[model samples]
Target: MHVHNSTRQLSLNEELTMSKKLIALCACPMGLAHTFMAAQALEEAAVEAGYEVKIETQGADGIQNRLTAQDIAEATIIIHSVAVTPEDNERFESRDVYEITLQDAIKNAAGIIKEIEEMIASEQQ
Candidate 1:
């Protein structure tokens, strides 16, 4: 059943490719509580949704877990949860991006994830 095994392997690969990868930038004007809390909320929501996510926080201390070129290339969407625009905002110029306030991100991270998923689904149709 070599042919059957090959077909199964290809299906698995396709499934992996279809899974969404999200990159997020979180910040706040004060660069304090809201920045870190929103980042954590987004991370938890993404994990629960079975999507891959990377979050970079720009705060008083500066950027942490900075997104790389590879991270940008592989991501399906960019989420910006901030009070002010992030330092390197132009980096996601060509990507599909969703912008939300830090307050919304902190209060309803899961809702944001659901909205993104719905957007992706509609685009595929």
Candidate 2:
């Protein structure tokens, strides 16, 4: 029974580690309010869903903590919730991209994550 419990725990941990990490870009035309808000929402949702997330925001001022090429390569998916076209689209090229509305990003972040999770599961199957 003890060995069985250990095996189950290890399996759970391995599943969590294998789950994809998502890199997201959230921006708006002005890149002020909506951009950061969406990033925060997505980050929170990813955490709750047990996925790692790295977010980059393009604000009116400039890009903030921009996503690196390495980040893009390592991430399993990309989520773009923006009013304007993302400036750094090249890095996400060939990646699984999810384009969503800013409002939906904020109000339904968890649902969005679940949708992406389901999509990935189906694709893998």
Candidate 3:
């Protein structure tokens, strides 16, 4: 149990170190409620996990605060919670991306954080 706890702590520390200014783009088919909700959820989760994150939302008004290539390049990971086609894939380029549903983004935010952290850790390995 001690070893497991230590490993978990180490993982969190590693994630914090690697998290530096993460950026994410969120959008949905209608761009009404789901997009905003997902963005909020992801931001909250990232904060809780010790990551500094900025999220962009694509809504009826069109892309708001659209993430730049620089933001994508600096992000440790990107999460897409759109129900339909996501238009921000190109921004991420070769960075780690997690494509998921808005419901999952809201209900499983911690899991999403864990998934991203694991990806970063695995990539380092």
Query: Against the true structure, whose lDDT is highest?
Result: 1
Q: 21-124 in candidate 3: lDDT tens per residue?
A: 65767788789988998898889988988878888888888989888876765566667777776664555546556777789887888787787777657756
Counting clashing residue pairs in each candidate, in order, gives: 0, 0, 0
- TM-score for each model: 0.83, 0.82, 0.77
Taking every candidate in turn, the Cα RMSD to the unseen true structure, in Å, is 9.9, 10.1, 7.9
lDDT of 2 by residue, 46-92 (tens): 98888788999999889887999778656666788888988967666
Candidate 1 lDDT over residue span 10-125, tens digit each = 24455477557888999998899999999999999988888799999999899999999788767766788988978987777656668888888888999988887787678557
Error of 3 at 82 (Å): 1.2
- Order of models, best TM-score first: 1, 2, 3
| Each model's lDDT | 0.79, 0.78, 0.72
Question: Which scores higher on lDDT, 2 or 3?
Answer: 2
